[model samples]
Target: MALKLRLKPCERVVINGCVVQNENRRYTLTISNFAQIIRGSDILQEEDAVTPVRRAYFLIQSMLLDPTIAANGSGAAAEMMAQLYTTFTRPDIQDRIARAMGHIGERDYYKALSALRPVMEYEGTLLSPAPSASAPSFQTEGLDLHAGHHAGG
Candidate 1:
């Protein structure tokens, strides 16, 4: 589905020039390809960024297969990219990714992100908000913070 993606350690990439069905078979093929990429690339040797990436991809695949993620309209897709962010080239890549994920359960995001940065950039779309979800909520009304109530007591 031609996705834009960002990976850890610094780089950008696109994914799926080839057609991919939203089925287990397709996902399995994708993961298998990913595994091969891992085997081929020397991502692991560079700054401790392999284990987490592999785990994150596993989690992403799991999320994509979930009906809830699919029903929510690209929740799975966002999560998938977010997972990749965990594997930054820098050491704190994991922490940053975890914070970005927020309430989402921990799944070694940092490690995974570091490892998959290349893959995401190569094969997926950049991370973006899900299609179905609304924008983040704001507490104050529009352009009237002092109008409705006194500021400074």
Candidate 2:
């Protein structure tokens, strides 16, 4: 099967562990054969992987991006799965995590990431502060926002 990819100007994509970037124009990429492709825009930067799910995501993404990463990250994959289990206790969430892990076990990195997306969204909602009218906002009348900093440089 042929996979046709339409890319915008300055877009970047990693194909079979090599990075290819379009310069200053729109273009279409055709993969006539099987290939591992990850778009630059879809990539999650390592530093941005702050949450447990994101950390797991980064691990899987790295494995997909590079074979060396895949070789070195097996233990990390197990640890990340365990962490996900500990963090998300809901049966439904756990099921999704297991599904992704199953894909991981099959070395289907792309599918694993796809399966993990909802868990990531759930984690985002869990971590984000949702403000309500009746919810108590902390009183900062006498609080210092920069308590640890000194006036002098």
Candidate 3:
């Protein structure tokens, strides 16, 4: 007697306006201005309210796990490196990944450590990914809270 196995087709992922299609759904592509969506999907199994700190932690972890990020020679040691780079360089994204990091660190050391490992590894490289033609331009002319809110969000 003989047995047969079956397989299903893979779904394509559209991220940061780039569509990466592959038969294997193992790899993740990290792009600017869209990490949140990817991270949220990857980290959250079900939809529910999550604190920014928790979201930030999960987001950084997801980025670190991405093959693209790991291939850049930035290993597990630099999980939150992606977020730190974005915070200082862009400083305009609606997400407060940096502030969330601080809050998590203040309240939970383990969570903070998990988030900071990446940042510590590539301190020098802690600059945001440069704006590409594909990226949207900054909107905040002023640095006030209201202005920052508009630009950041």
Candidate 4:
């Protein structure tokens, strides 16, 4: 299979750890061989990796850049995931982590990264400051409101 990329002017991509930039015009490239490729849009900056999920994404991205360090990267990601498991008990977060783990087990950093993407957005939601008195609660939704002896008993 081939990976086709259509980049805009001044766009950049990381191909097998090398950063390549397009000129001031549209450019297209078809990659025929298996190579690690990450577009600028998907790149996570070190400074921006503040949350646990972001840090995991960054580590996996590093694996994409340098496949040789996958073991170290996986270890770091696993440590972070352990902490995250205790911190976030939501079903959705758990599901995403499980999926990412499967991909990681296969040494498919790209798919692992994709699996974590939703968890990243979820982390943002979890961390977003509550501005009002009626802020959202992190507790399992219906378990609090409907799962009780009070509702039916």
Candidate 5:
């Protein structure tokens, strides 16, 4: 099956380890073969990786975007994963982390990235300090702390 992508004007995407930028107009692309592809919006910069999970994600993203580092083995990725396992004692999160590692081992970078997203979410809840008892309950939606951006700010 082909993966079809409709990109906005000036949008960028990494396809099979190559960075491609759209020109003046919106464009559509059909990837007929297997390829590692990620949009610019989803690309997490290394400097933005603040938490342990985010750091692990950045390492995996780097492996996906740059084939050379992946070929050499991602020692940093393994180390980060180990640290995350030690830090987060939740069984479910640990299982997801293990699955992410399996995906990475199988060279399925996209799947690995997907698995890490939920792990990050769970980690956020665990690491966040509890609100005061008198304070009103608040929800954290569309809030990406690692991105250093607050929702509706």
Candidate 6:
């Protein structure tokens, strides 16, 4: 099946490890064969990869964007993935990461990226502090509650 892509003006896409930017106008493209493709929005910047899972994601992104890295057999991506596997013990996250690894091994970078999305989101939840149970809820009982209502009433 062919993939149909409709790109906005000036939008960029990485196809087969090459960065291609759209012209000043919107354009549509149809890809008929097997190729690596990533939209600009989905690309992860290096500085944005602050956590272990993010780092792993960045590595995977790098592999997909750069053919040399993917061809040279760099173990860095695998090493980082292994570290993440050890750090995250949740069965669901582990499964996603493992599936991503399988996709990587199969050279299916897009599928690997899809599998890693939930793992990254789960990592974010784990790293973020949970809302405090004792936090006070906002109440409109006391101050100026009638003042605003009177103007509209």
Candidate achieving the largest TM-score: 2
Tens digit per residue, CA lDDT, model 1, 77-129: 35654655644544455544554355234332234444445554443333443
Error in Å for residue 52 of model 3:
15
lDDT of 4 by residue, 1-153 (tens): 998999999999999889999999999989998777888989899999998789889988888888677756787777877776677788888888888877777877777788888889988988998689887678675655544657456
| Model 1 accuracy (lDDT, Cα) | 0.40
lDDT tens digits, residue span 32-111, model 3: 33221222233332142143333444444433345453244233323443444454544432133454345343433234
Q: Provide the lowest-lDDT 10-residue window in model 1.
A: 34-43
The predicted structure with the larger TM-score, 4 or 6, is 6
- Per-residue lDDT of model 6, residues 2-39, tens digit only: 99999999999999878899999989999999899999
Q: For model 4, what is the error of residue 113's alpha carbon versus the real structure, in angstroms, after optimal superposition?
A: 1.5
Q: Which model scores highest in lDDT?
A: 2
- Which stretches of candidate 6 lie above 4 Å from their native place? 23-27, 133-153
Query: How are the candidates ranked when ordered by lDDT, highest leading?
Result: 2, 6, 5, 4, 1, 3
lDDT of 3: 0.39
Query: In candidate 3, which residue ranges exceed 4 Å CA deviation?
Result: 1-43, 46-56, 59-88, 108-153
**TM-score, cand. 6 vs. native:** 0.76
* Better candidate number, 3 or 4, judged by TM-score: 4
Every model's TM-score: 0.23, 0.79, 0.21, 0.75, 0.73, 0.76
In candidate 5, where is summed lDDT lowest over 10 consecutive residues? 144-153
Question: How many pairs of residues in model 1 come into backbone collision?
Answer: 19
Look at candidate 4 and give me any clashing residue pairs: none
**Model 4, which residues run further than 4 Å from truth?**
85-87, 133-153
Please list the C-alpha lDDT of all candidates, in the order they appear: 0.40, 0.88, 0.39, 0.84, 0.85, 0.86
- Worst 10-residue lDDT window, candidate 4: 143-152
**lDDT score at residue 29, model 3, on the 0-100 scale:** 43
The residue-by-residue lDDT of candidate 5 on 110-150, one tens digit each, is: 78888899998887887899888798876779866567465
